[model samples]
Target: MNTRMNSTASEAAHQFIVIEGPIGVGKTSLARRLCASLSAQGVLEEGAQNPFLERFYRNQRAAALPTQLYFLLQRAQQLAALQQQDLFAPLRVADYLLEKDRLFAQVTLDQAEYRLYEQVCAKLDIHPPKPDLVVYLQAPVDVLLERIAKRGVDYEQRIERAYLERLNEAYARFFHEFEAAPLLIVNAASIDPINNHADYEELLAAIRRMKRGRLYYNPLRSRGI
Candidate 1:
């Protein structure tokens, strides 16, 4: 909506852009906004339809496996649709990455369950196209907690701060080692790119500037720090 992110958007029309982060980090809002901004298809995770999700949240230890397995099947079905597309299909914006499912599995599932999950995933071969760019959003635990509370999702109310902290740390480590795509690591502790035009455009400019490798989106840098 705001100047189309770039005028020559067609050059990158085939890009698969993904937004990644822990829960409450604004992945869905940004992904949807960016999809509309770029005139691309919106691909969101339908974890809410998993049926096992609410129960898992209510009693994670008891329902983790079923929840994780349901998600695995759901992802396979979704990605399989993408895989059926032409390789040159127009740009798409997804709130999640294909590989990051394992990240969740690692954090949520234990040794035996994780192994089984991996084995099942290996058989699915849900090899969707990789994103041309990944925007990894990060925020402090307090900010994340505040946003979570504000969203008023009853299931998410059961999430502990400790688990969110651990998930945040896991995300940091994953992105630190990630190299499959150009990474844009945004410190979103102080800005709302989805609701504020300036913040949104700042990230758009950063996307315009990034061509390869990794970059950091630090608001402090803009403050002359």
Candidate 2:
């Protein structure tokens, strides 16, 4: 825990942090761990509990708009609360970024629908606090599918392999050009941040080393185990 990276991350005065990745890449789990370590507030995305989610899984074309709308409204409400209150502690970790909302819209909606969605989003005036650090987790689609299956969410059981593949690609494309904050791109395919203290330590170190711009982390090649 006293590693250079860990020490640096601890010393830094970061008010906002975001852990982002495709589904089942463990963003929420990492955010939880980070919040615990930092003694910070954690804002997690409420996934699948939305009534429209199961229907979207069963019939994407029929349920896409409603599912998207539900998520948008829920996220907006959360952000509104943050705006009106002392939502952040000395440090704060959120599992989702408001901008990432667009990624789903682009992926799940048709051209016309997406255009309409964008129009609505443009009017929301929701300015999320910029993260001091944005950790982008990456893994193969196969790994994502495996993790999702292991999690045993009944509605997610029917998640098509093709959709997962597309989502993976979309995430990759989004993060490739992402520059909203200091970025740490982590290869999570072989790294288990939970139940793997070494992996978690390495990640903490990597975050500290991130000073500006973007950095890449392949846990397969970390030092001094």
Candidate 3:
């Protein structure tokens, strides 16, 4: 998903916000809710439009290349459009980050395929709009698999637990090295930011208070405070 950053003068701190997590972590739902709260534009991934997604889910190895390519092109186009115009000028809250594409490519692609993918990516010249803040949702692999089951998308039924574990680890590695913007890591296992109001409020407060570097919004750990 691609989002724009057009914030109210009151919220200069969060013009562009990105909510990221592994699959089925409710990050997209949080992004939409944040858009409502901030009166910002909502950018969602058009995953339904990806013809190869279902196939990729069914056969990741067989379909990884096309699936990745489709997503790459789609996200590039969406972000490029964001670059072109801001007439609507809605503040931006998005579910996905462009840089994370390489994470998936690394996990799913073999060496030669990854090489080709990188070459194509360089050609696309993707310079994503820098988000003012990134909200990363984290949950245990078991929790992720359970959520995926609860959602019950047809193609997602084919997803394996091993893949989820691997994806989670990859995300961990990426965010560990991430230094592009202010980072807010949320322990999504214990709190549901999408459905629980108290949790959401706590997260909102954390967002308001964050000034620099990496911060965490773990309510369970803050019980004593």
Which one is best on lDDT?
3
- The ten-residue window of minimal lDDT in model 2 covers 1-10
User: Which segments of model 1 are wrong by more than 4 Å?
Assistant: 1-14, 221-225
User: Candidate 3 on 17-116: residue-level lDDT in tens?
Assistant: 8999899988888888988887877778988789999989888899999999998999999999887877655568889999878999999999999999
Per-prediction RMSD in angstroms? 3.9, 4.3, 4.1
The order by descending TM-score is 3, 1, 2
lDDT score, candidate 1: 0.84
lDDT of each: 0.84, 0.84, 0.86
Model 2 TM-score? Answer: 0.90
Which pairs clash in model 2? none
Model 3 spans with C-alpha error above 4 angstroms? 1-10, 87-89, 221-225
Instruction: Estimate the TM-score of every prediction.
Output: 0.91, 0.90, 0.91
Residue by residue across 60-157, what tens digits does model 2's lDDT show?
98899879978988898888877677622346799998977889988899988888888888888788878989999998989989998998998988
lDDT of 1 at 27: 93
Report lDDT (Cα) of residue 142, candidate 3.
Answer: 87
lDDT of 3 at 38: 74
